[model samples]
Target chain A: MSNYSKVSEFKDGVKKGIPIGVGYLAVSFTFGIWAVEGGIPLPLVVFISLSNLTSAGQFAGTGLMLGLASYFEIGLSVFVINIRYMLMSLSLSQKLDRSTKVGQKLLFGYGITDEVFAIASTREREVTAHYMYGLILTPVIGWTLGTFMGAAVGIILPERLQVAMGIGLYAMFIAIIVPPAKHSLAILCTILISVGIMCLIKYVPFIKIGEGFALIIATVAASAVMAALAPIKDREGDAHE
Target chain B: MNKEMYYFVAAVVMALVSYIPRALPITLFTKQIRSRFIRSFLYYVPYAVLGGLTFPGIFYCTDSFWTALVGTLVALIVAFFEKSLVIVAAAAVLSVFLSGLFL
Candidate 1:
């Protein structure tokens, strides 16, 4: 690609990323306060945000840490929480431009959060390395910056307000799944099945499961059931749309 | 290990587990997946996971059950309109804060 086009694609990617960055600021800010409130040090909280760049994984992992759970539990919970990214990565890999190098793929692969994958995969044109980099950078900055600010200043916030902000991340999750769920019965069934399974696990006294394991069970069971019941015939065209 | 050392190690492990899933697939798999079941499974994973993560947990996020419920309803209403993430999230937080005052 020409230098001008590469730069423009990069700029366009940044433009698309701005909203995601803004959204991340709110969610990660909540994460930061929650993590610190859980007894994590300020610096470590920031470091976690910088390295993980994921809301659910970071929250679960750090919560496990604060509880003094075994390292094995921490690793397993985080991996389970984040395993969805692999499917996203696989789907996005098919959308990348043919000329994208292996090195570029490796580097940009690290940047494929849920929001990034959603925007990149929905694009009309094939995704490029430059565009992915631009898209990734803004959110990373916003996530890290938000974490730092929240951890540093969160203690000063009123108790009620802090508690209220706890709903932000879940609200974001609702926003994400609800739109897609509204569009397709299959998706709605899949989500309902997942929630149903989760409720059973949580409420049923005989079935004792950890939160991480519960999530895995719900996700796998729901997806498998829906996939079997309503398999998508047109993988390429119908999958993305 | 000491407490600080333990936390650091945990962070490293979490980071590794997080990165491997993301980096492994895109870097290693270039070909389209052929299995219809797997493709469909992958397609539904996001919704299922997000759904599982959000509910039950969302109800307990705020101080009171009533506030959380109010916030959840507001979120559902805003998101039903296909509002942006920030707006939906902010609406929930604001609703919770406002409801906390009354109840």
Candidate 2:
């Protein structure tokens, strides 16, 4: 800990943000293209990316623009998909510096994407505002910039490349969960449980539901079941891959 | 173009709706919680929810299920070794892109 100056820590935070940001860029680029291809204007796509920051929420919210969903439906969808963030933020809240100001915390609150929370919460030291800001800065740039570029070029890109880029979003999802799931039975079970539940709801005619509602149910149910059955000892220590 | 108020309004609403859940935890986390059980539960939420988000959806993201499967296999292999996120994601993308040529 002696070598860890505030500046070096800040640099480390920025470094961690880079891969997350790059992954975000590709995922959001796919969003921008999809939204635009779905008939949303470039400006609105960029606005949503700039303001929304997260992936699933924005994609769920775009239903409003497509006439396939009502405004109320879009709002409800965004909330359900984004509800996980509250838990992430709650867990992260426990990890924040004790002396951190409310206003700084408020600003810091918005940047708690899954990857950011994953990195921040696993750290042994309390996360400071300086470190948080450094961690956030690049992803903010990457997300909005990717949105702009994707929207600008979405129409012009060849069909092959556009379809190829769609894989990037799921690829990012795989990268996030596979490492931890590989090491832990609880994690592997959680994936199977949630995915199995989702599959039943998706393919079975009697139990089908809206995408947002299905996600909320799957996530909450899986988390509750696992938390009860396979509680990780707080002092068992965090896992990093 | 002039009548898009509803979309913009929806975006603002989504932003606020999303912000509360994220920000509220700050007040909760700063104070000492009385219950040890609930604290431990919150620790696992990210993992479970991340799993919920990952599978089935990953397999169905592409037009061809075969392409997606190949991509998932490639990614899982890379991620199993604890490769960086960028490498894992790129591996999935490239594997899918390659498989698309044949399948």
Candidate 3:
């Protein structure tokens, strides 16, 4: 692609991803304050918001951190929580420009998340470096800013309000998944299994494992089982040409 | 252990590492997705994730399975008919809170 086209693509991605960015930042703001309230450091909360950019994983991570879990435990929890994103990005790999450099592809792969993937997957042509860059920059900034703001204002917020904000993160999840669930059975099954497995982890007798390990085992076990039993077959034509 | 400081450092390190994985792929890959397995996985995976997250959200609270069950059932019923996110969450929360209060 020409330099002009690349720049424009990048600009387009930034624009498309802005809503997602705004939404993420608002939610992460809560995360930031929660981390501080939970006894985490302000700068560290900022870094987590800036770097991880995942609501569920960070929530789970901080929960574990508060419990004084071991490093191995934390690592395993994060891995399981985020393993699905790897799948999401890998699926998105097909939409990129075929001739794009492998090095660039590897570098940009880090930005794939529910919102970014949702926005970029709808693109009609091969994705460009500029497009991915645009998508990442906005959301990254939003998440970072929210976290910083949250940490700075952590003390003033009422405890009840902070707890209520946790629902915001959950609301985002519902927004991401519910619209699609109305259409697809595979997704419905996945949701069912994920919840079922998690509940089992929480209540089942011998399975009273820690949350970190429970999250890992539940995700893997559920995904693997779902993959084997209910493999999704292509039905409709590609939405974007 | 300077618990707060330890968490702060841990958050930064995790944030960086996590971003690396998320950002790297989108930057690098630019082609038509061709993998059938991955395509299928992507298509259905969202539901699994949502169910996984939501199920626990509705059920994890309360003293026993009965309260959790009642709360979640009400929430699901409300969520099914209602498009509003707030209503769905409220249904779940209110159900649980009322059950806890009355029981």
Steric clash pairs (candidate 2): none
Query: On a 0 to 1 DockQ scale, where is model 3?
Result: 0.29
Q: Write the residue-wise lDDT of candidate 2 on A11-106 in tens digits.
A: 878987887777666556677777888777788878888888887788777866566566678777788877777777877776666677888888
If you assessed candidate 3 against the hidden native complex, which CAPRI class would it receive?
A: acceptable
Model 1: how far is A89 from its true place, Å?
Answer: 3.4
Q: Model 1 over residues A1-241: C-alpha lDDT tens digits? A: 4233788889989987886787677557777888888888888889899999888788888989999999999998899878778767876776677677888888878778877876676566778899999999889998998898889997334778777777876887887878888888898999999999999999999998877678778988998999899998864644533
* CAPRI docking class of candidate 2: medium
What is the TM-score of candidate 1? 0.79
Which has the greatest TM-score?
Answer: 2
Could you tell me the lDDT of residue A48 within candidate 1? 93
Candidate 3's C-alpha runs over 4 A off are A1-19, A34-44, A56-81, A95-108, A113-131, A155-163, A209-241, B1-12, B23-38, B58-103
Tens digits of lDDT, candidate 1, B53-92:
7878889988899999999999999999999877998899
Ranking by DockQ: 1, 2, 3
Candidates ranked, most accurate by lDDT first: 1, 2, 3
Clashing pairs in 1: none
Which candidate number maximizes lDDT?
A: 1
Candidate 2 chain A — worst ten consecutive residues by lDDT sum? A232-241
Model 1: fnat (fraction of native contacts): 0.76
Q: DockQ: which candidate is best?
A: 1
Model 1 error, position A117 (Å): 5.1
- RMSD to native for every prediction? 3.9, 3.6, 6.0
